[model samples]
Structures are given as C-alpha cells and as structure tokens.
Target: MTASAGVLDELDGIRWRERGSCAADPDGGWFEDLRAPAARRARSICAGCPVRRKCLAAALLYGEEFGIWGGLDSDQRHPLDEALRHGEPLGRVVDCALRADRAA
Candidate 1:
C-alpha cells in the first residue's frame, strides 16, 4: 500500500513498532551520516532490528529525508518514496533498486 505522512501511528498494534533496535539510541544520532563507514555501522544495527521493515515502511510512507531506516540511507529511500507517492507498484520499486545495486 502507498504510505503517507504520519501513517506510522496506524501501525501501533504491530509489535515491531515498539521493538526497533534504535528506540533507545540517543536521538538516533548514528544514522545521520552519509559517509560509507557510518552508513555501514548504521545498516548493521538495522540488520538486527526486528522492526527494520516497519521502520523502512514508515520512512517511505512519510517521505523521511534523513538518517538510515531499514538498512537504507536517505538516497536509497528517495525513489521508493517517489514510487509509492506516484502509485507505482511496490515490485517496480524493488526491481529498480535491484537494478541500481547491480549497476553499482
């Protein structure tokens, strides 16, 4: 489903919503960097987060423009959010990401 701003509240009943690994991180400071090393560390944390998918969905749904969510940096999330906003199918966005990854 396409996501919109403040949609995370609708997921309150989802257990992962309360189980994000970064919940206790000091304002999620570690996720703000665009540097490769910092991004790697942040992604490592997200990789272990139970709520990784939810966090990513929330970010994409809301057009979050900062920090790492669901193992993705803001740059990685941009096209996904754009696709969702434009009513593109989710699979198309995934395929685009895969193509970009392969190209890189």
Candidate 2:
C-alpha cells in the first residue's frame, strides 16, 4: 500500500448512486445529474487511497473514467495528458475515454 488502508477506505464513497437505481440514466448510475462534478469529488476521495500511484498507473493503462482511480479521474486528468505525463499506456483501467474536453 502506498500510504494506508484508510486511503482506499474512502473509495467506498465513490459509489454515491446505486448501479441501477436512477431511472433517467440508462446505466442507473448514482449522481447522474452531476457526473462531471462527481468525478472531481471522487478524485478527492482518491487522494486518500493507499496505492494512489499504482492505481493511477493502472488507470492510465486502462483508461478508467469516473470514480476515484489513482487519485484522479476523467474530470481531473485527461487520457492523453495522463499518458504524456506518465509516458505510459492506459488500456487496462479504461479502454477509451468518453470526454476529453472536460479533462483536467
């Protein structure tokens, strides 16, 4: 662990909305009304993750968006920007990015 179990403990907060509870969202995701804001908030939650660096690396490799992955998310970091900054490929966390303009 990079810091402590407490880091990831905050990750549970990422699931603010139930998977299939939202009637508006096809996926029934939580915080469907504020997806952009949710991503940022989730990044804050990631700041406490113990394996933040590793998680970020994994996210970068996978291209994970939304939620707190590696102390960041689609709202806090762009896919290409992440790859350029870390000089690595993100095909593991996210296969592709949904929005690049809103990237941090």
Candidate 3:
C-alpha cells in the first residue's frame, strides 16, 4: 500500500477522540459553528489537543466539509486535503499544517 494509505489505515484504529481535549468540552457547538469567534475557540481548543493530527487526518479522509478539525476550519484544511487527495504523504501534509498552525 502507499505511504499515505498506510498512514490512514493506522489512523483507523486510534481512539483519538478519547484522547482529544474536545472530548471533555460539553459545549460541542463551538466546533460545528462557522462563525469566526466559535471557529477561533474551536481552533484554540484543538491547538492544545494531543490527538490534533489524528483528528485532522480523519477529517481529510472522511472529506468533512465543515467545522474545525485539528485547529483548522474547513477553508483552512481545504488545501491540505486537496494535497492528500493528490497523493501527498499524509504525515507530511498533517505535520506541515500543524507547524503552520503553531506559527500562526
């Protein structure tokens, strides 16, 4: 299998949601809202999440078209998702997006 496919396969077994900081957030609305303030809050919560990369990978794999994942809104993740769809390594794309998120 290709490296990106393998990465996605590995991601399948991980219980990332159990480890995510958002798991404890009772107000899950922040993640689903497209408003700037809510999106920012969701991203902030994701910024400190241990499973952020996995979350992002899953979002890309599933073609999630809305909300925030891995500290990035749909628009932010679109380019990375496209790169992955175009056969980019999942690890490379995820890591780059995370690094950019950190730098921002």
Candidate 4:
C-alpha cells in the first residue's frame, strides 16, 4: 500500500463497508451517498487519507467498472477506466489523468 492508500485500508485493516464500497439504491440505478456533498469535503476529510493515492491508482491500474472507485465519482473518472480496460497503454492513461487534473 502507498502512503496515500485512503480509508479503505486503515489503522488496522480494510473497512470495506464503510470505505469505498458502494450501496445500490433500487430506483436510483447505483451508488449510496457515502461521501460529502462537495469535493472539498472529500479533500478535507480525505486529503491526508492513508489510501488516497492508492485508491486513485487502483482505479487507474484496474478497470474498476462501477461506483466511485477512487475518491472521484463515475463521471469524474470514467475515461481512465475505459482506457485501461480497453488495453490502451498505461502512459496514455497517465497522460489523461494529468490532463484531467489540470481541468479540475
């Protein structure tokens, strides 16, 4: 795990239910509202989050196909996921993140 793995992996171990794992709302299609309403809420509560980078990297490294894989929501992160899952080069994905980060 990296220094910024996030809440999923914590002081003792993985807290899957409370962290990163998703909830399905019957009519809503997907996702349970586990995060704060604003991005700052996430960045504040999760900035020094032990698994922050790891969470983001996992979304990039593996083509996780649902929910908020990293701290980012689906729309915020789908491009990188698509690129990796389609066998696109890792560098392409990295570049995309860089470009996206700037836009953010």
lDDT tens digits by residue: candidate 4, 1-104:
75435322432333432453222212231344545354434433333344444456665655556644445556767777677678876555655664466466
The candidates, ranked best first by lDDT, are: 3, 1, 4, 2
- The reply for model 2, stretches above 4 Å from the true place, is 1-41, 79-104
- Clashing residue pair totals per candidate (backbone < 3 A): 0, 15, 0, 9
Q: Write the per-residue lDDT of candidate 2 for residues 1-104, one digit (tens) a residue.
A: 55335434533443432221221333322223345665455445444444455555444544566544454445555745655566444333232332231254
* Best by the lDDT measure: 3
* Candidate 2 displacement at residue 80 in angstroms: 5.1
Q: Would you list the C-alpha lDDT of every candidate in the order shown?
A: 0.66, 0.43, 0.81, 0.49
* Clash list (residue pairs), candidate 1: none
**Quick one: ranking by TM-score, best first?**
3, 1, 4, 2
Off by over 4 Å in 4: 1-40, 60-67, 89-99
Clash list (residue pairs), candidate 4: 4-50, 4-51, 4-52, 5-50, 5-51, 5-52, 6-50, 6-51, 6-52
Candidate 4 accuracy as lDDT: 0.49
lDDT of 3 at 26: 48
Best prediction by TM-score? 3
